[model samples]
Target: MMRFFTGLITVTLLLGGVGTVWLFLTPSGTNLRYLMADTLITTQHRSWAKYIIGQHAMETRVQAYQQQFNEMGEERDTHEIHPDSVPAQAPAAGTNHEAETALTEKKPLVEIEEISGHGYSGYVMTVNDPTKIRIGVPEKKGRGERVLSMAERTGAIAGVNGGGFADPNWQGNGFQPIGIVMSGGELFYDDLGKSKSTQVVGLDDNGKMVAGRYSLDELKALGVKEAVTFQPRIIVNGKGLIKDAADGWGIAPRTAMGQREDGAILFVVIDGRQPGHSIGANLYDVQQIMLEHGAVIAANLDGGSSTVLVKDGQVLNKPSTKSSEGRYLPSAFLVFEHPELAEIQNVWAGLKPGDIDPGKW
Candidate 1:
């Protein structure tokens, strides 16, 4: 009888040890129902063991779950975002050549300009499929095609008005744009007669660089693209080209940008040609800093004394010439306040509220 009692006690103790381990491994939920109702848990010692084991099991369960998840493939843990899809937050404008290249792949709503319908006589084309464009300067052929600095060309005379400033024998004041082309992931057309002169022939179909500017070869090495000269300027948008030079030069190498805010795109032309007290543009000028404006891309054209803004049949700004005779420009970008354009229906459009048209004075 004593031996039978000893065997029963041993069996009970063995069952209790195994029960504790099982409770430690198992979580309390619907899955644990059978284990909870098991006769073993009804005992005081068994119930106490469950509580102690459950505390320790919680930590193990978490670690096990983490380990299982980590065992999956790396592909399940990663995602990719395209640079083009997001508006780049850049420290400075035009600095991210690679990101800029990504943007160039997408067609812009507005392009720089196009050089079509250009007869030696000069004709008009549409900007962004809207707005009329007219070129009256450069005479449209041969050397006349290139832009000359106003002060550099004493022989520059105004073809529109036959004044001393209009003398063709002398190069005149005011900037003349050569050809407008898009390059470097940007939409602006370039002008040869501007403060800086550059020609960029970029990445071609051959998968190699073709031409470049600034010696950086940015256009060639990257996906920079271009277009022809159309109405790239504001008043110059649909105006005629007039060949003439102003006797004076106001500033040099200045730069500006057209910023879009609310519903208006304002042309922020900065004067950096020379010191505020002195004349002529230099580096570090507010507008000349170039990178601060974030101009995805930009081009500098003729400026200085010849920089004239004509509106309402009158000159709006001070003409740099010592004489009020606005330098005879071979080409003039004029803004018209009255007539509207046919392309966008009304045509005369500008940043300001007044309807505007581009013309040659």
Candidate 2:
């Protein structure tokens, strides 16, 4: 009996040692290790990633990603869109006669289609009229608002979350935006000084999708109507930036915006972290999706737990939050029937970066 027990223990130990060596020494295992670390960096438990990849290596990886994103923004985007060619309505469901009649009638303001690839699944929302898209903010004074609430308050047809903020320990109030926010062709918030520049994703006066790095003067010259600070324009001039899935920052929920040649705005909301339903996508996956959908220009938006889609005052996608509603965000891209009528007041009007407390609820 003792010999049998010893033999079993010896076999188990041998197997465990082999598994440990394979996990640490193999290329595929290393890729997975870094991937896990990258995903942790996006969450509140960022420090835990050190166990997988050392603290120094993790910091180096993050800095490298930041540099890459900054360089991507530096490349000029010279794409243009003409909204006149875009079909104003969805095609009728069944017959040719109905389709002919529907062509003349006003089409649905937004069209949503389910998209899936590899290990991820999400929705793509196309706003037929790019001109009717605006950045909606929170109604109250202090805290940030959910995308659903913003859509409901503005009576918008659809919306997706926008930009990143000061989320101290991932429990930020969502009131303070990182760089800049522009709404209704007005400068709502600006932290970048006169000479500095930031990567921005927004629309110009002609409803052209404007993205990439630009200073205050450049944004003004382009007549950007609705803008928010974000990073890494993934596609520009009809070319994908990230080379492959391995280079895609990490596998996590993603939100991205793109513009077709016909001037329709595309919003991609990918869900992640859920085991069987979705594992999420990387930037390369997002870029490919945009290119497949005829995007001439595309930019990454604030994602992860903040990824959400709202239509007709109802949450359309399953948000990966404890409440399933999504995180409080400072800005959202909302589609309105009469976007000019949306009353989005600047909540950060008089506050400075130092003045706001992101940790305060």
Winning model by TM-score: 2
**RMSD of candidate 1 to the true fold?**
32.6
**Model 1 TM:** 0.28
Cα lDDT, model 1, residue 319: 41
Candidate 2 worst ten-residue window by lDDT: 86-95
- Judged by lDDT, which candidate is best? 2
Q: Tens digits of per-residue lDDT for model 2 on 172-259?
A: 8898888889999998888776648999999998899999999988999999999999988999999999999889988889999999
Per-candidate TM-score against the hidden true structure: 0.28, 0.94
lDDT of model 1 at position 118: 11
Assess candidate 2 and give its lDDT.
Answer: 0.89
For residues 1-361, what per-residue lDDT tens digits would candidate 1 score against the true structure? Answer: 9999999999999999878666555664423433332212212233442354363554454355334322311111111112233343444575577876665554332232211111111111111111111122333211222222221222221111100112222343312233443322343323344334233322222212122132224333444432222111211111111121110111232222222111111122222213332233321231222223221222223444444433223333334445444454434322212113211111111222121111222
RMSD of each candidate relative to the true structure: 32.6, 2.5
Instruction: Quantify all predictions' global Cα lDDT against the true fold.
Output: 0.28, 0.89
lDDT at 168 for candidate 2? 88
Candidate 2 regions exceeding 4 Å error are 1-8, 85-99, 103-106
